[model samples]
Target chain A: MEKKLKIVGFLCNWCSYAGADLAGVSRFQYPADIRVIRVPCSGRVNPLFILKCFQEGADGVLVSGCHPGDCHYQEGNYYTRRRMMMLKDLFCFFGIDKRRFHISWVSASEGKKWADVVTAVVEDVGAALRGSEKQ
Target chain B: MASTENRSEKNTRRESIEQFLYRLLKEGKVDAVLVPKRHPGGNIVSPVLISEPSQIKGTDPLAPVQTVNAASIVKELVKEPVDKKIAAVLRPCEVRATIELIKLKQLSDESLLIIGYDCPGVYNVKEYMHGIENREDKEAFTEEHIHDFLSGDGDLVRESCRFCTYFTADSADVDIAWIGVEPPGIIVAARSEKGRRMTGGMNTGDKDAPTVRKETIGKIEARREKRQKSGIDNLLDLIQPCIRCYNCREVCPLCYCKECLLEPEKMGYTSERYLSRAERKKQIRMPVDTLLYHLTRINHMGYSCVSCGICEQACPMDIPLGTILHVFSKKIQSLFDYVPGRSRDDELPLTTFREEELSEVEDV
Candidate 1:
């Protein structure tokens, strides 16, 4: 049996988490690679969380938040977007593959979009893992 | 805008500064003066707190070596309110760090006098010590170093100083200008009411700042910008030798967290967990998470990093930690148009958010 790639998804409660739930309810198909952890808001996701996931052997990390101006706490997603973007740049500078860590905005109403995003993320992460194995 | 012109025509630069400080103490303007001084052995120079005017004899505030950022010392001294005011003579970096500390509530400005000067930067302690080992008068080291640096002999200075643009204490209450001025003279300009009050009795003459100062500052900034651009690419390579000793965190003036999350207990690692992690990774570094530690600090202190570079001095591995930090911070701070230690009124970037800002950072 081959080792399974572990993808950690941090979903904001107001939008992305609900979007994930809606995907399940609507019977949308997506990869089971991602293990979702629902946070109060994307702003609550510290940069340390992504680093910790990587350190604990996560092959990929995805942070999904409410769209700008649609945050449950008014501006949490905006802060998250700024912070995560900077963190992504930092990871790139650290020589980590940019594909391993990702951030996106998915509203609660977009269950189909959520499935598509997850499918794309899982594929990218799986590709990265395969590339590393060959190396 | 009270600027102090050179009062004495014959005194050397060091003598004039000493005289100015001596008078401040003698006239009872400040209860104590915190300045660097040569030890009785005449080898090392360190910060000293002198209450009496006569005790200021060995004071050499312009030494070309900094043992530690005096802002941390100021934090300790001013943690409690003092009955009498104390004056601190600090470098540009120290002044900026003190300002950041003041905003952090770690140090109070009340009953405290901040006197800062134009800095030519300092040599690392070991380098300075080695350079001055055969010298007869260690007191002349600062003047000699300045002359050499201005003459383009910069190998003696620390790497951080070579690329430092903030060579003037723009944030200080009182700033002493000397970079482009004539020798044996310094112009003191008071930026705050407290500074004005302290210098009211000095009766020093006023002179217009020569335009050469601006040109000199611009040249240094251009050089630094060039150096920084080239050095940023090797940041990961520079930090690869990190032993995870956490010396950088300990030496940082802005890392004031009493309970840092990087601690082993906070990281939640069991004894067996290391073995398991090593098994999973095939080979785990003995002291793990060096990159995480650096990133966490950069995130925590992004807004407060004064770029003092004391962390680089403390690193045993000789990593140019300051350059790495400054590169990241300059980018993040520009995102918010924020400069740490610019002013007490300038809100920290992490604490405040504007509705229509940072759209470029978002994925829409």
Candidate 2:
């Protein structure tokens, strides 16, 4: 059997974490690859945390927060938006595969969307790893 | 007019600057002046805080060497609200870094007067020391450097300085300009109201800086911009030699964190944790997280990086950190239309955010 790819998911407590919980309650099937870590808000996800995930041999990382203007504590995800964009740019510049890292918005009501985001991220991370191995 | 002519009569630019500083002290315009001067027996030039008037001799602001970015020293001098004003004569990069420090709240400029100068780039410390040792008249080497710089011979300066666009003090209160001036005399041009107040009685030369100075600076900037287009593409390979000495962080004026996450103790690695990490990878790099350290640092401080090249200067492995960080920070700063050290009013990129900006970063 092939070893399982470890994908770290940081979900904001009020929105994304609730969304993931809702997905489980509704029996919405998604990839089992992600190991979810609950965070207070998406803004709590430091860029260092994402980098540390990669450094610790995580195959991929996903950060999910509330939609802009929908934060439990207003404007947390807004700052996260700017920080993640700069981090993504820096990662690309350092030759890190940009596809392996992902960011999305999944609100408490969006259980189906949470499932979709995970499935897509798992597929992307798998493809990216396979592509790198061939090279 | 007599003082202007007398200044021109001085043998070298160093003597004229010394005279001006001496007068500033004697006239009690400033309580103390922080300027770079050689140590008692060594050629290494470092920032010295001189309160007495007679101690201004041997002070060389135009020295083509920077052992440490003087902003760090300025931070120490004015960490608390100071009662007496001190004038700091600094290079353009130092002035920019000082401005950033002030904005970051790492420094208090309450009793600080910044006097900036037109820089003619600098050699790395080793090259500068070698040149000074070979030269009989130490002052003559600076004159030779200026002459070479004016004539477009920038081959000898450090790589960062060669491609530096901000080689003059546009943001400084009072600028001591020597580039493109006739007869090699310094021009003291006050750029701000505070600068005007500070330089009210001082007479270095004609207050109106020549039009040629702007044109010369424009030419150098254009040349540097062209060189900057081909930035360091292989940054990972370039930083491979980094021994994790933290020299870059130590020397970076903007890296004023009292508790750094990059410290080994902060990582809290145990013997079993190390073994597990190696087991997981089948093998692992011993001094782990070198890449992680660099990336995290850039994320934390890239917005505020002044690119003084002091980090590059302090690197033991001689990594091209200055050029890499300069190139990286330029991109990051441009994303938010933020220029570090450009002004005091502009908010740091990470500190403030606009409601309707960066919509592309969020995936719906």
Candidate 3:
């Protein structure tokens, strides 16, 4: 049996956080491996903050915010997306499993998609973990 | 050995540089000239822009030490719609800083000329002067006296300049290489088109600065050898005295941070990290990455290093910051065949990234 991965989900209150709440209200189910931390905005997540989560025992970290242009603080999510893209690119350039970090946009109406993305991210993290242990 | 020029000639530094610029100002060769002078209070000095030749009387070209990079200010000075060219008087470092800023598009070269001088390193104004001794003893030093006063065989120099190399200009448009200690005139090395063109008129002095250049070279090499032996430990010692006072960064001519990303506000540094004595080591927040900031800036801008020692001159701890930056800059330049100020056409390493680089080095 494979060990369960501990994934951390940082959701923006304005969009993804509410969307996750809606997922629960809509009875959409996903793996309980994810622990949600509510942030006021996605732009509040600094790369160092994400790295800190990984260092503090989070096997995976997912940042879900409003779509690029729909950021509550104008270009907040856009900045997050750009900086995250650099981090993701850098991680992949190194040999780190890029699947460990996922960034997405899910509005309040996207409860089904929210469950689907979270389920997919956890599944990928579990796959990477098993692959790492085999070595 | 030939030009026996000597004396505390009645001519102030104002007269020498301005006398040269007077003709240019009259000939419309330059639109403006930027230099520094002892302010009205007779103590603090800063770089100022001089437009009229008549107003050039207050200029001091041979200030015993300089604390600012006048080159960045020159870039700022030239932003106007100039009808003609502008000439800037830069210590070797300031000139280099100006060129780096120019490459970054922070400055324009459309109508700009540089007059770079051999830098006789300056005091960290607050530390060596105000912090250690009397304020009115300003008369105690002179540039002619530097090679003697800072011989280091007898006494420590103002720690910063003593450790710095590039005390002379290798990259100025008009290099005002000082000939010798006595007369204190310069051997003008012209490496640019504008420099050669403008000098077509003046009865300029010959190149005697390099005769002293060998001695300067010897002194600098010895310092480098000693620094290489002791730099890491020397750097480790500075963390104690460094009060996180951004004086080094603030006074750095090149540390032009519109919003310094390293600021606690910007980096989101918190106070609780230092709660436990043992925890300090785990998260040493003491001016976090102070060394890295200096190193990165050097890596970022050193190749174009004008050899101006202003960064060292600015550190309040009297950290020989410029020496470290120059060391890295020198090493990287040798590694990559890059020399700052050799040609404006050459691309800076940070600006250009090759896809195929390090393929040969991968096996090593």
lDDT of 2: 0.84
Task: Give the per-residue lDDT of model 1 (tens digit) for A1-135.
Answer: 545668999999999999999999999998888999999999999999998898777889999988888999988887787677667766646656778887888999999989998888888887877887798
* Tens-digit per-residue lDDT, B55-170, candidate 3: 76656666555656786677567645465778888876677677777776766676788888766666555643452244453322343334453354213344545555556666
Per residue, candidate 1 scores C-alpha lDDT tens digits across B82-112 of 7889999999888988888888888778989
Which one is best on DockQ? 2
Could you tell me which 10 consecutive residues in candidate 3 chain B have the lowest summed lDDT? B355-364
TM-score: which candidate is best? 2
Which residue runs does candidate 2 get wrong by more than 4 Å?
A: A1-4, B1-10, B203-209, B229-233
Q: Write the per-residue lDDT of candidate 2 for residues B48-67, one digit (tens) a residue.
A: 99999999999988888998
| TM-score winner between candidates 2 and 3 | 2
TM-score of chain B of 3: 0.75
Q: Model 3's DockQ?
A: 0.04
Ten residues in sequence with the least summed lDDT for candidate 3 chain A: A86-95
Note the residue pairs that clash in candidate 1. none
Candidate 3 wrongly placed segments (more than 4 Å): A1-135, B1-15, B79-81, B127-140, B143-156, B181-184, B203-237, B240-245, B256-260, B269-320, B323-334, B353-356, B360-364
Clashing pairs in 2: none
* Model 3: docking quality category: incorrect
What's the CA error at residue B89 for candidate 1, in Å?
Answer: 1.3
Ranking by TM-score: 2, 1, 3
Error of 2 at B104 (Å): 1.0
